[model samples]
Target: MLKNIAELNVIVDKYVHWFNHERISLKTKGLSPIAYREQVLGN
Candidate 1:
């Protein structure tokens, strides 16, 4: 169970990076998720 949890954590981290850095969003006017989040949060 612990090993599975660790592997899941790694997968989730990779997905987070891909979503935030690589994937674009139509709702954000084609901005990457990270950029759109920053814009909305004023960061």
Candidate 2:
């Protein structure tokens, strides 16, 4: 169970990275979600 939990955490992290950094969003002129939020919100 512990090992499975660790693996799941890693997979979740990878998906999060892909969603935030790799996928381009249309709302911010085709920038990744992370970049768009940073630009609009001021990181």
Candidate 3:
């Protein structure tokens, strides 16, 4: 269980980071959303 608001915020931050930067999706052809975006944009 979350002990405090600060800890909860930290947990949320980690989850958001993972969702955007780490988690791969088959719909994205096995790339994370951010990676796919970068590839599309030529970054």
Q: lDDT of all the models against the reference?
A: 0.90, 0.89, 0.98
Residue 1 in candidate 1, Cα distance off native in Å: 12
Which ranges in model 2 have alpha carbons more than 4 Å from their true place?
A: 1-3, 41-43
How do all models score by TM-score?
A: 0.59, 0.68, 0.94
Write candidate 3's Cα lDDT for 1-43 as tens digits. Answer: 8899999999999999999999999999999999999999999
- Pairs that collide, model 1: none
In angstroms, how far off is 1's CA in candidate 3? 1.4
lDDT per residue (tens digit) for residues 12-39 in model 1: 9999999889899898899998898888
Candidate 2 residue lDDT tens string, 1-43? 4478889999899999999999997877999988888988989
The superposed Cα distance between candidate 2 and the true structure at residue 30, in angstroms, equals: 0.6
Evaluate model 2: give its TM-score.
0.68
Cα RMSD, model 3: 0.5
RMSD of each: 3.2, 3.0, 0.5
Error of 1 at 21 (Å): 1.8
Looking at candidate 1, the ten consecutive residues that score lowest on lDDT are: 1-10
Scored by TM-score, the top model is 3
